[model samples]
Target: MPPYPTGSWMPVALSADLPAGTVMPAQSPAGPVALWRTRSGRAAAFADRCPHRGMRLSHGFVRGETLACIYHGWSYAEAGNCQRIPAHPALTPPDTIRVATQHVEDGGGIIWISVGEPAAGPPRFEGLAPLRSMVAEAGIAALEAAAGTKAAGGLLDYTHDDRAVQLLLAPDGQARTLMHVLVDEDSNPDERIAASRAAEALRRAAEDIARAGIAR
Candidate 1:
């Protein structure tokens, strides 16, 4: 978890979390993103700010294949080019009006956004299934200290009691981290619930350790 370089894939969200015709705000190493899916079910990420009046584009609406800003109703295509200006429907919007775009990939139950051109694709969890995602108030160092190990290629092996849970961490800003909980694909319902609670406990401990400056 927490790949630091700019030219790599960052797992930003879960595919199930972003439904068709909806937009949500996500963060990347570059900046904030307006992650959205078109009515036709194609996903794309754009700069979160609207070009018209500096409004957050994540507050926009999705119609067909375009995302429209809620403030001025300026719609943009998936490629980040402005497609329509409601105020001047007769005039085609110029190419100059556009938002920044990032390459997005969805697989292994996670949504990945690329800040720069990645040489390869995101890591695939071959034998695990994503349970849920949570925001931890601690950094990666703290999480590693709490888990008693460092992550390997985005997979953090954490042991609770005798059970093992794989945690995938994604960084947000500086002091926070996004934790994606992964369980064995064959885990039972009880095991899954227990794993969730254990992850929460780990988060609390990591946060405490980070606050106390004990994470090294």
Candidate 2:
């Protein structure tokens, strides 16, 4: 079986973690990506590299609707077009000076980035609230061993201490996983806390399995 689902909209981050007018580092099947939301609360994803001097745009800061490179202050609009060059304030940047962008969807409290030209929108899990996200230093096989079952559609159903939750996972490179925890929408505060703790324990268990060189 495949490690996890691929070639569709991938859950990259929780919407709550990314406030408006902020930029964050993310991943894509193509390469590293820069995910950001504008001051108007529009989300956009771009190839992380700056077209001007090869700087990582994730390190850049958001200014209004544009994300500006931290190195030379080259500003790119939400459409990935270079709008301003600080060094040449009077010159308008050419349209060719643009950063590559990808399709983004923010729904069901998650930020989903399309892997390619997907034909459909992201899948939604009704009545699920995102709890938290963390990286596990383990591959999918190790995680499957820890959870006692394999993932389906990039989701794994896990329960601990009679508390059940869903884990949305995406491969972070070769041997790491980006996991997002989700609890029932109506779950109370105490239950949310418990779910978070259970997810942490699962992460530790998976890591241990990976370190022991155990393959599922």
Candidate 3:
């Protein structure tokens, strides 16, 4: 299987994992990102580093519709503009004091971030719904070896116990991968559980293969 396009939309997290008024650390092709959702439920992604004190923005908290740096209370808007500086409340913050932002899309129960300017939106699987996400200590080659199949367009199809499950992969660093499991939208609870387990098993097998240096 070919690697996912580095400049295209990459699935960073499941939509359900990021609730309103929360921030989480995520990986993008550019680097680490502070993926967050405002109280009004808008998803946004910003450079994880804070301009002031060099703190991680993902460790910050959300207030109203803004994300505030945890170290010195520097607040930033969803558009990456600096809104407030606690030490200089009487003075307006300069527009230049802002974190770099990236394009974000929330669709089909997934959250995607673009590392570069994408000509179109993220890929959509019409009848599949996301089940869960897991981090594997292996690469795409190991996954393909375990599943006996290749991935195309960042998606791999695996069959377990006569049931079909889709795996969406996002490479994280050299040998780590983030896998998102998807099942039919109309699947029952039992089937969903089974699929989740199957994915876990696959992850273990792939990791083993990677550790043994046998993945191709």
lDDT digits (tens) for residues 23-55 of candidate 2: 999977767999999999989999999998999
Q: Model 1 compared with the native: what TM-score?
A: 0.95
lDDT: which is higher, 1 or 3? 3
lDDT of each: 0.88, 0.89, 0.92
Task: Indicate the residue-level lDDT of 37 in model 1.
Answer: 96
Cα lDDT of model 3 by residue, 70-187, tens digit: 9999999998999999998997999999999999999999999985788888989999999999999999999988999998888989887777789999988889999999999999
Rate residue 45 of model 3 by lDDT: 97
* Model 3 ranges with Cα > 4 A deviation: 214-216
Clashes found in each candidate (C-alpha, N, C closer than 3 A): 1, 0, 0
Predicted structure 3: lDDT: 0.92
lDDT of 2: 0.89
In model 1, which regions exceed 4 Å deviation?
Answer: 214-216
Task: Write out the backbone clash pairs for model 2.
Answer: none
Task: Give the best candidate by lDDT.
Answer: 3
What shift in Å separates residue 69 of candidate 2 from its native position after superposition?
A: 0.1
- Give per-residue lDDT, candidate 3, residue 82: 96
Write the residue-wise lDDT of candidate 1 on 1-216 in tens digits: 455466677888888889999999999877899999999988999999999999999999998999999999999999999999988999899999999998999888899987588888887888888899999988998899999999875668899888788888888878888898999888999999999988998999999988898444
